[model samples]
Target chain A: MKLKAPECVFSSAGFCPGCGHGLASRLVGETAEELNIVEKLVTVVDVACCSFNIDYWNFDTIMAAHGRDIPTAVGVKHVRPGCPVLAYMGDGAAYSIGMAETIHAALRNDPVTVIVINNSVFGMTGGQMAPTTLPGERTATSPKGKDPARYGTLSGVELLKGMDIAYLARAELVGVGGMAKAKRYIKKALEHQLNGDGFSLVELLSPCPTNLNLPPVKAKQFVHEEMTKYFPLGEFIDKGGDK
Target chain B: MSKVKLNIARCKGCGYCVDECPKQAISFTGRISEKGYDTIQVDDEKCIACGSCYRVCPDSVFEILV
Candidate 1:
């Protein structure tokens, strides 16, 4: 068994050390390869850390305006219905600034796959407190740590649940088990697109070591231990799967 | 026996793979990579090709050949 890097993954990425965007993009590439949709893949990335996927993945990519990736992907799908369009964004883009677009896409059940990298902070910019920022989590903006009463957290999966989407799930990238589960969820989301099912979204709990001010190892542990407690893992909704 | 290869130049020394390796087969080589971070090496004798390192590496550093 020789595990080779995905062919769709080209030159090195620009993410900071221990950033989970690299791994998340690699999983997308691998999923595209397995589904044999590389040539037909059009990724619309948000103007955040996730924009790095435009370089990491060897696919037709569009760097959309901040927090507009979902609608941008919807537009691409409208013109190129055959292409498997993916909206790649971070929690800040998907849950914060792009909240309306994100919700309406699921409400309309648009045929696009949205992968949100939830790192709990505004990664590319300074480490500001994002919508997904855990209560008591320290960020640049929340120097004293996020206050639950003052600033509550938002869970993408929770907001999108009960919608008529094709699939919905959340997974992390902490250990081998988590990564494996994330790949499975991602592959399923892409499969739903090929099947022409409505919208699909997979929120990946990733580590922002630079923003969290933790070392790589500790960041991984933080997501595995602390983040999962708030945003539990597993498929929240699988319309196509057996109930 | 199995082997894990490294793309030494692209490494950022995040040490995710080093910590994820269940066999404890990988370690920092003390030599700096082109990225100016300590590069890691694998002990082939201790490696079991579990692919944990390959799965956890953010930079795609390891390729496991069994």
Candidate 2:
């Protein structure tokens, strides 16, 4: 039997060739469609690569300044308490500039779903090194590779280790299996918010082939082989509804 | 046999479908898409319509007919 394709209203997104943000955005749209929340979902997008998705997804979306998506989403949730709110951000916006906002939201248990595309590089600004950049991985800023001895690689999800978070998980978008897992994690994070569970976050290890200076196929392999070594995938916390 | 269709105009030729196809049924055509990228062509006889391409394609370029 043929599976029903997700009804993404936009025929195409403006993302570059082989960019995982398009796939991640589609998965989130699919989840919203599956849950029948497309009409009631509100999105707060940060001013990074993720901001481009406002045109791709057919939902009520608000653009937030760099690293302020969490606060904007929190405010949206307060005004539209009956609807589900999602904050979409890239690693540069979420892990680096918006780290404090993300941490406070997780700590306060704000009823919002946060999706972080941890592509390790600042893809929009010409592949600059991000906080989530892997150790020894070269980028525009880290031309000689990231030296952990000088600057430590930060794991954003790990910051919520002892905090009271509703749901926290990390998944990559590489092969079929990885994509499937990412869909599940994204759906679950959204579900938690609909069920009135506290702040939920799903960090997706997406690929940036153009920025990474690798072919699209090899970029997916790099995600599975090299990226996973630094950022392991799995559920870190789940204290929301029964799974 | 299941049928596979490609939206040649929409494809970016990233080869995600080619890499993920379990049957090795998908390949890039030498012909360039309107977008100026090599588009993929599916070998229908080899395709099982497993939907791996449908699932992994970031561009929503494939449609599987069962």
Candidate 3:
């Protein structure tokens, strides 16, 4: 099947080599275009490498402070209830700094789509250890490898497991099959918002080759082998039209 | 048959297309581009236009024409 390039991403992204942010952003752009919501789409980006997407996406984009993207997205949704609001953030911003905002939004069933790119490290800040960093993973902050005893890993999806979320899923962007699955999760998350079904979150496991201190090919392999071992891929919750 | 095209200049030498290619049709040309990254070359005879490279590439370097 021939897939059309997403025109919404008009310019090339400035992410690192083999970084998953580009692919994740492209999937969101493509989904917004496919759903015909490009005109009514408002994206709130957190202060991370993902925020650079503002330069590429051709939508009403807002840059929010670190960990404040969810609240900003809530405000946008309130002002423009008819528009589909998407909050794009990284693991550090979403899970560490904005953890409370993320949970409360899900608890209240806020009508917004939250796209979290979990690359296990803070890409923009030179690969610091993030809340989603896997145990034993080595980062700049944890040069000796992550210590599960002190710096434990947290699962955002698991935190909202029993909540009444419209949709919650995690997918890896390592290979073509995984990329296809991530695209489906992203589209489903946006569909929930367009349908006014309440809160949705799609966490994508991506690679940070530069931060991971590995070549792009090896970083992709790391995501498929090591990262997925801790953050499994699949739909954790899907209260959408199909179900 | 479907074909693959690469914008070598935009390539970051990630080799994602090489790893994802089921036919092992993509390989680095050992020549660096102006951007200081190794460029990839496609073996047309082995490629099946599966678009696997197009899908996994973050740089938007590959175009699969059907």
Candidate 4:
């Protein structure tokens, strides 16, 4: 299947200077199509910056209110029956505002695939903080930097693994190596959803220098360093294994 | 006697290979591809065929015929 034939084009149509979101999003869309999920794809975008992705997508894309993308996707999955869905959102919407929806969806084992773009800070909302913000990280909200003593632990992969979801992975789009592994996880997630299993979420530690107030290169290095320390790279849970 | 291959598209023109070449065989004159990415070139004589370029590229653009 010729997959890049999506309904969007042009670099400006969907990407930041060094945003790995575009790379991961295109791969997901194209891979889903190759796996025959495009025709059945009903992407639910949240109130986060990914809302613009709705306009750039070629499949059934919908703009949902803050933190409600999960239920919206679940609703679409329940009604559409066999249609595959990819619920893409940023950390702010998924881990913070949408936490309730995420938990319920996972608890009920909704047949939906989720693509969580964890750029650490809320890129769209003025580079503020998010639950997934790395420790000792400085954000617009956390101007003094994130204090672990007050915030506690933060790891989306670990958090989701505790949910008992059918498929879950936390990877990065930092480089070609990471992108390659992420592509495999995306393909697997779509198949899991289409096959009528529980929830599948792929948390991508994306780069957002524009928001993070760092150069693109430095931002990427942050993912490979600080971010990877808290979240840690590799498959946190796959087919329900510790590895 | 060995194979040295490359994916020119992935070469980001960083010149990491040019500086690190112990043989001083690699030279980059800023020639870019249709993809607008500057690629690396090899001065075959200076190349000891040690595969340093293969080791350095983050994209793994270099391939050595083992």
Which DockQ value does candidate 4 get?
Answer: 0.07
lDDT of 1 by residue, A97-179 (tens): 99999999999999999999999899989999988999999999999999999988888899888788999999998889999
In model 4, chain B matches the true chain B with a TM-score of 0.78
lDDT of 2 by residue, B1-66 (tens): 548766777789999999999999999789987888988899988989888998888888877778
All candidates: DockQ:
0.84, 0.72, 0.70, 0.07
lDDT of 2 by residue, A1-243 (tens): 475456754667777778898889889888999999999999999997888888888999999989999999999999999999999999888889898999999889999999999998999899988888889999999999999998888998888878998899999988889999999999999888888888999999988998999999999889989989989999998875664
lDDT string for model 3 (A1-243, tens) is: 565568888766788889999898888888888899889999999997988899978999999989999999999999989989999999888889999999999999999999999998888989988888899888998989999999778988889889998999999988888999999999999888888889999999999999999998899889899988888789988886853
Candidate 1: CAPRI quality band:
high
- Chain B: TM-scores of all predictions: 0.91, 0.92, 0.93, 0.78
What local distance difference test score does each model get?
0.90, 0.88, 0.88, 0.72
Sorting all predicted structures by TM-score, with the top scorer first, yields 1, 2, 3, 4
- Give per-residue CA lDDT, model 4, range A1-243, as digits (tens): 111223332122334545666656666655865786566678899876688676566777888889898899988887888788788998888888888888788888888888888898888878987788877788898899889889864565676677777798888876556766888888888777766667888888888877888766677778878788888777665563332
Lowest lDDT sum, 10 consecutive residues, model 3 chain B, at B1-10
Residues B1-66, model 3: lDDT tens digits: 538767777788888888888999999999989988888999999988888888988877877787
Q: Which residue ranges in model 4 land beyond 4 Å of their true spot?
A: A1-14, A240-243, B1-66
Each candidate structure's TM-score, on Cα atoms with residue i matched to residue i, is 0.97, 0.97, 0.96, 0.75
DockQ of predicted candidate 3: 0.70
Error of 4 at A33 (Å): 2.6
TM-score of chain A of each: 0.98, 0.97, 0.97, 0.91
Q: Report, in order, each candidate's fnat.
A: 0.80, 0.61, 0.61, 0.00
